[model samples]
Target: MTHRIQLAGHRWVRLVTRLAVVLLLATGGLVTNLASTAQPAYAHAYLVETSPVDGEVLASPPPAVRLRFNEAVSFNERSIQLLDTNAEKLAIGTPGHVDGKANTAQVSLPTDLTEGTYVLAWRVTSADSHVVSGALTFSIGHPSATAAPVEQDAHRAVVVVDAVGRALAFLGMALALGGALFVAVLWPAGRSDRRGRRIVWSGFVVLAAGTVVVLLVQGPYAAGTSLAGVFDPDLLGAALSTRLGHALLTRLVIVLALGVAFGLAVRHGSPPATTGTATTATAGAAGAARRIVLPAVATVGAVALPLTWTLTDHAQTGVQTWLAVPATSLHLLAMALWLGGLITLAACVLVPAGRRETSRAITLEPALPRFSGLAQVCFAVIAATGVYLSWRQVGTWAALGATDFGRLLLGKLAVVLAVVGLAAGARRFVRRRGREPLGVDAAPAAAVRRLRRSVVGEILLGVAVVSITAVLVNTAPARTSYAPPVHTTVPVPAAAAESAAGLQDASIEVNIEPARSGSNVADIYLTGPDGSLVAVPEVSGQLESPDRDVPALPVTVTAAEPGHYVANSMSIPFPGEWVLRLDIRVSDFDETPVRVRFTAR
Candidate 1:
């Protein structure tokens, strides 16, 4: 009978995991319908407006170039650069704020520039500590046939290493928070479990190491330099000055404090609190230290540790930040407690007690039920916060399929579902065993083995979820990252009726692809009431930034098909309200203007 139950349970577990994977692949429609409608108000920064639009042909150099972003951003002297057509670096003014606006950066241009096409490369740190960089071109004369290539993104290896460091930190955090909770609080023999103590100690070391790695690599990551810059004093100094650096530093300190508390909890959990004081007189001292000192420090450190992450990460920047921060911290705490506790439980209790291999009897009396209760609470917290955070980060239904962040989230949910399935079985076992006359340890050997296998599966799935989450952390939130292009058609101006015959019943159709920022191509089609292209004599274009307080920038519109006009290199200076005005010259004297208004992402 036990064998039959175990086999059926294993098969059921396998089926659930397979179903979870299939559901993940096809869950787009289901998730969108179920997703909450709350959208984040703010996110990462992108170039909103520039003094001179990208790809504009300027007769003379502008005195100063200003940049504006949709959100607050910070930059240093190294944030802006001028590169000539030949890829030679040129000196530019130090980047600073314009009129005390944190989102705007201004740098004086050198009057000596003789540019065929010069690339202005700018890098800035957003509130979330991610560095966004891009390059735009403005020609002094006509657009050059060939210009130097610009690499806007950070080095691939640097990004990968940074991600690895983050994964390690997350893993270490789980172990430190959850392992310590289980060994010191949940399991009765946790204090004396040699293997368990070692695991907790290893967690501290790994967490600290990962934090140090991220701290060092952050210099290169932000500066757009190679790995060699990791040790550069200036780069390191700049990194330390940012909010992310401060958070990492605080995290390290908290890790140290927490490590000390964990050490004391296990060492003096049943020992003299202090070193070398085992006497009865000092027993009172030990009791006070154990009962008062350890718990105080651990509680504070655990609470503060997640704050370091919440205060600098995605949670700190978006809408209802006050709420997001607390929710994210709770999410992290629940994850740490659940994952770390499960790993510790499986290694120290389930495996040994199931295999029945230990010389000392591994009792299941109170620890199993206690951990079961904690796990249940942790899962509840995880579900609540996960739903809220997912809604905040991924606002629209389209974004879930369009952005990298959204896809990663789906993958994470899949793995978590598999883990949840296994966890349900484990919880059921605990509940059923608790009601028996005999203790949980009296479970048949097959039943214990089945429980052990499910737990191992849960741990593996949990780690996979953590890995996906690490990548997700480095990606931009889908709410801000996904931007659809502009496509609209406006009726012909009334003046068109007096200007020409076909123009009376004709309309202008405009399409802009990937219209976020920088260079974009605008396609304009003149279609008559019959829905056919109507040729015009001449078309001249200008980009108007009326809302941004910038002068009109010339756009070079050229003929394509009969009535099709293409602004092959329409440069959008920023992501806000703008108009692409086309002056159509139908005859020698008659000219009418058609304006297409749109918003760039």
Candidate 2:
């Protein structure tokens, strides 16, 4: 009867191992390419247009300020602040979504506005639940009498804290998930190892603390406030109001449950007592009864934590959330399992051998091949999921090399490949060991040394991968860089013609397009006073808004058609009456400099 039960337990273990392998393979193949079809700009919210368009010099304040985005947004009135040059807040009504438009939000403005420049700074929740904010300045009559334009790095403190919190959370997840797996599967003897237990406990603590920090930082980040606001109850409350907040809160709850599972696993799976140790056989029997149960609970919590992470990040905002979220969550799990297990193996199994503990070290030899097999499965999943995410994130090959996010991703990939190569080396070492028993002897010790070095290399590379991943989460994906610029034609209402250098033979007719505070194409038509086309030696222009103390904007024109010269692109920095000085070279000997007033609104 005892032999039959032992055989059944062994079969159960084998079945569970087979199931895990099958799941990883099936998941990797099933959605390996799904993310490639997802939306290119996974989580970024773009401002399509704004009312009182950027740099508009309005004679009077508009009734309301409207901002349109390409994606649906969650409106927060308090997040939209109107400040004058002195940085004094203006009276603005609550913000609301525009009627019949899901992507437009507007805020009512006070009609009684004085003649001073005002800046509208806004933060909104994008469809993917990420916060996006920007500032636009428009003058009431003249530029506001205030301090010099403050560099926008005003929220650097909060950004740093947010990034730190993200890194901690990611690191914590790796430890907790990986550490738990080590104790549960790869090294059951780890149950008795002090380092292994501490690793698991430390992982839980780190993850929990990181989650708290992230929750605290989210509110202030969304509010675009300084570091002090992290403690603001109101701001924290505002964070809790968003879907992201709920996801974070749920993660905390899940972590709490995860802690309980770890505790239960420890209590129910206490190691065999050493000679003279006070631990009882009864306790061990109890542990044996509930051994599978505690690990199962731990596995669920591990999976749940990654799910919450996916819900609040790019995966959630991705075009195919259904596929991306699960695939990404699985990817994270695979990483955690592979990395965490290796860490545990090194610290508990391999590192101890260096201290001359050959007996304990030999006990770990059986687990090495098992972990290698698992790692192979994990690496496959990582590669498959990574390919899908790369296609989704980087859209084009040019962007992969050109964009910051893509560059970071490339760096991460290079390091991962190195880690994989090391892992392969370790696997080769494991295979060469064959069925021969390992010991404290020279050959086995050397083999162990080689494997440990490779494992250590992998761990170091893993840290780099995680650090880069934290930064990647904060970066705008490469796909966003591919968006085409908005180009619109704005006809210059004035047909005002200016003649060059005492010569009425060639007059310059200048027209600016979509006269706004961005790149605009200038059409300079050279014509005779008789309304006939005329050609000039060369044509160039510059813009200066004297009222706003703006500098000269250089414009280089090229001949696109006969008698018609066009500025490839010129930037109009502010909304006002800009003097478009057209330098028309009528001849090598004589040049005509003509000035025309261009209203950029």
Candidate 3:
């Protein structure tokens, strides 16, 4: 009877050991899946090239300004605009129309215009619905303008790519840590029970694989090159030379070292021989503690790796950066733990039993409670961190609808809510009572099946979240394009008076000469009652014809020598009849509003 009892005890130990190994392998597979799926390929829109090249000096203004993008763009309100040096509004003839079925927009410019320097301002809505806008200044002649070029840095891209890679790394760490914890807490004491050792080995292999991928891919990615360029020594050297690169390299070394230490522990610290009750308990505790240490170290390293990247890459100061880093870190870790745990539970606890056709032999009886606890923690972390991250990225409540980033975030949140509902269902099932063959009440087999299905649902939703996140990081911030308005002023001259048959002051001869090409200049030469030229001090006007309510044209008048005042660089808003109300300040005469109609071309 004593020998039979000992043999049954050994069998039970062996069974639990196998279960643990399978769980670890499953979780490792989850980490691998995340590593493969969560790559940063779908983020922001890229500008391929531009016509009348950015910052190129043109002798004459181009008929239209064209911008080509890698993806389709949205033509919404305030999508594109053109402004001249004097802050006078230049007409953007029409909305952006598709160029020959390609993703490009051509905005037409006015034909007749005196130009010194003009700024082409554009706002393009990326295919992902993120709006990106910038200004480029080009001179007509040798004139100088004080506008600077917009700078584009690879910092955001690096952060996004590194985040995805570190997410995978964290997944591996969680699997290894959780597996180690399980092994320590429930160590089987039998020579045949080699499951704990197998799990530890599998975890190490996953960690090593994830580390290699990150180390290899990060170099080329940092250099803004494709995967094929990863092996280039120059690219690798540049990446390693930077602060971000060096930190990532250090993380890789630490992870590899941890893997090595885990392997050593597994080899030299096998469970002690289980001779009797006291020996079995002592052996189990020792084996469990040994298994636990390696994963704990791995978890610490994984958490630190992402934290380092976040600190070095995110430039926001004070509480903003602090809040963003921790929230993002927790968000990443929770995703890994939940996804990795699901995989472990499925592969180790479910697949083997199903394969062996002994569905009842390795029942969900012992595994459900542990999984439920893990799921609860995962949900809490995902929710809390997700809320914090959304708050940081979307500053205003209206931004949720105003910007593309906020919209995608909303979609991700909805999916997460659904996942939470599914988890709730699983929790309910585990708590319910059911009959057992041994006369002990336990969770029904059907409940376990439902729990598995819920986990799968959670995994699918998690994938959607990753995809959304991948695209969100590429978009520009919501508040970048809305800059304050600029305002300026200019002067207009009167038309030269013509000699009539009886009245000499009836006719005025106005010579409209552009001081510079692409600028609005109207010169008016007026003959006074005494046959002397008079200077018009101020001129107020409106473009009256096809379009009304044109911008206020600023006019400035200068005396060419003495009597003749030359109006130079007077801005005209559009092509129409412009009524000039000139306040003629001649000697001691009353300020007169002289209305004159002139057509602008």
In order, the Cα lDDT scores of the candidates are 0.81, 0.70, 0.52
Model 3 local distance difference test score: 0.52
Error of 3 at 469 (Å): 3.4
Tell me which of candidates 1 and 3 scores higher on lDDT.
1
On TM-score, the leading prediction is 1
- 1-601: candidate 1 lDDT, tens digit per residue: 4344444434433443343343332233222321222123266777767777676678898898888787777788988988887888888889999998878899998998775888889889887778889887788867677777888899988898898888889899999999999999999889988888988888888888888888899988887889998879998998988777877876776776677567656764242233332343345544565676567667667776787777677887777787988899999999999999999998888775435555778777788889899999999999999999999999888889888999999999989989889999999999999889886988888999899899999999998988898888778999888778789999888887667878777889999977766778999999999999999898999988777556687888999989999998887777788888999898899888888888887
The per-candidate count of clashes, in order, stands at: 3, 2, 29
lDDT for model 2, please. Answer: 0.70
Q: What local lDDT does model 2 show for residue 295?
A: 57
Greater-TM-score candidate between 2 and 3: 2
Q: Model 1, residue 197: what's the lDDT?
A: 90
lDDT of 1: 0.81
